[model samples]
Target: MEKLLQTVRITINDKLYVKDPESSDLGKRIIRESIKMIYEIGFESFTFKKLGTRIGSNESSIYRYFENKHKLLLYLASWYWGWLEYQLVFATNSIPDARLKLQSAIEIMTQPTEIDTAFTHIDEVMLNKIVINEYSKSYLTKEVDQENKEGYFVIYKRLVNRMSTMIKEVKPSYPYPSSLASCLLEGALHQYFLMDHFNSLTDCSIKNTPTAYFKHLVFNALND
Candidate 1:
């Protein structure tokens, strides 16, 4: 999988960035350091000037890549989703059994993220934490509809549709596959959030894993 991903390029929406970060060393550094900085300090506290100081580049240079911090966050979120979608497609596309295929997709979506060494500049694990902690900031806004129309979320929506198709494969007669799929994806994030900040609100812990809960919920819901 590592070798396969070494040749793979996770594409982000072009509109999300003023310049493509993967196109240059400086751009890559911006992405790499931005992830590190955002992971260290929450997004609300993150700034381009701080990133510029960390990377030893002028703040205006950072703006040459991303118009603003909000666009930067959108770029990051889109990149993460694109990366996960590639993993999902690669892992489950050849599975012959419907139930097992659906289960595998669920596992990929719900399991704890590990660092993907394939992308040297980005840390998948920390990006997952950002997604869990700050992804809502990317879309929870009045401009979300316009962004959606511009396909800012196509990768994420495509991922959900992939899972939804897998669900239908598992249970041809079942209704609500898309709903179930979206729930599994979003619910995993919510459960992880609860486990991290509001332990009493959720049963998922280091041992009880959101992966296990979602697998159980999905399979039972599919009546497998």
Candidate 2:
């Protein structure tokens, strides 16, 4: 626990420096402490008074860094995505083969490490709420332009394209489209995590676990 706290402190310091390079040492300390507090209490339950007390600074001092709670949460979400992108890129870069690349991506996505587990839980709790709220609203629904929709599709499409390229190398005669590969990966993840119930008739077991099922899907995708 001590080691984890030290690591989080270091990460907070690094992030604070990146965001505000000119900030004083004292300012960085306060920001780092505030982040630690947020990780413990969560965004919804975190209070200005509690943050101030933890950092040994008043609410006014904290406000200098962020205008409001919503703004802070937005910044955190952007930072979290940036970190995830870095990890994903690094994990995929090591495997020379396409099949291995796809396998590595699935493994990374489904299995959360100790550090990832902490951040993932917080992100799902906070960001998922915001996403659900926005997506549920009529105004927000209409506001999603084609470009933004395409951007979201691009992430999945790129993964499929990479897998397809690899599959071609392995078996040039394979008939499955990149879209189908994408669907299989996405569907497997959704069913395993987001689905309310795993239909036993399909021989799928929630008890079988995400990593096990994900590996099965990857193998089946490559085989077919």
Candidate 3:
């Protein structure tokens, strides 16, 4: 509960929601229960009616916070990325060795996540599951470009930018820092997902864990 011990509010784009879920009890409940319900039954099978029933609120109450279930999902996914960026910065900011910093960033991004207690309204563990399974759908849509233009992907991009900067510091001559950063992020998520549904597509065994493998790949590529 270290996170809940202090008040930490991770902000998302105001345009992403009809109301800010952090501002009031009902709004927070909408965020909290929606994450649980969505993670339980997949986003496609989730809706305001079910969410309302779970939390004793109505669809209109839920709509007051989010335009629809998709927006709610975006809010959850965006909050996770934002939280991850904070963790990456906090973990790497003090490491004087650029290589060590990069390794720590890899661990933060790739290794399985534990629930963070700072934001009591959020179950970081379940949210991580949702992200691992459904995050790409948030942007793999026809409106991706429009959402990007509207700043919906700012947190995720900022995360990539931060990690890319770390990569550059480790290898100023490296040409594909951004590409590598994104691959590291998306690649790790893919491995996590595939480990569940298509085990052959990934090798996350303890012998060559995903975090360790990414570290090896990154360091070998940079060769710094």
Candidate 4:
């Protein structure tokens, strides 16, 4: 898997950035630092100016890569989803059983993230935290319709569709495969958030993970 990942490059939407951050050293630094900064201070308080000061570069340099903080957040979110899609494809492609393949995909989506050494410039762990905590800010906006038209969310939608297809494979007669696919993806994030901030509201935790909960939920629904 590591060898396969070494040959992979995560593609992001061109409309999401003025310049590709993976193209240059400074660009890579911007991504590496932005993930940490956003993870530390929360998106509401993060800015390119602060990121510039942290990375010892001019704030204008960041604008050359991204139009604004919102676009930067979108880029990060897009990249994370693309990276995850690669993992999902590689991990489950060889499984012969439809049920086992879908089970592996669920584990990839809901399991706690660990650092992926394949991309040295990007921290998968911190990026996962940003996705969980600040991802909604990227699309929960007035311009979402316009951005959707512009294809800013193509990668994320594709990831969901991949899972939706697997669900259909497991249960050909299932009518709500797409809806259930989206629920598992988004619900994993929500369950993690609730586990951290509102423990009493959720049954998921360190011992009882979202992965276990979703696996039970999905298999039961499909079998029923």
Q: Evaluated with TM-score, which candidate comes out highest?
A: 4
lDDT of 1 at 139: 93
Query: Which digits, one per residue and each the tens of the lDDT, describe model 2 over residues 1-224?
Result: 54553343112223222244124665556445545656566556777678788767788876676666544543443344344444556678867887677677666555433354433224343342232222223123453465245342243345557556655665677777465556554454454444334454344454666667767865786586
Stretches of candidate 2 off by over 4 Å are: 1-35, 115-208, 218-224
TM-score of every model?
Answer: 0.97, 0.50, 0.95, 0.98
Better of 1 and 4 by lDDT: 4
Identify the superior model by lDDT, candidate 2 or candidate 3.
Answer: 3
Task: Give per-residue lDDT, candidate 2, residue 220.
Answer: 80
Model 1 scores a C-alpha lDDT of 0.92
Tens-digit lDDT track for model 3 on 1-224? Answer: 46444765677999989888888999988888888988899989998999899999778988888887777778888999999988887778899999889889999999888878677788998999999999988999999999899999999999999999999999999999999999999998888888878988777765678998898889999995
RMSD of each: 1.2, 7.8, 1.7, 0.9
Residue 89 in model 2: lDDT: 66
- lDDT computed for candidate 2: 0.51
Candidate 1, superposed: residue stretches over 4 Å from native: none
lDDT of 1 by residue, 16-37 (tens): 8988989999999999999999
Candidate lDDT values, in order: 0.92, 0.51, 0.88, 0.95
lDDT of prediction 3:
0.88
TM-score of 4: 0.98
User: Which regions in candidate 4 have their CA more than 4 angstroms from the true location?
Assistant: 1-3
Winner on TM-score (2 vs 3): 3
**Residue 37's C-alpha lDDT in candidate 1?**
93
For all candidates, the clash counts are: 0, 0, 4, 0
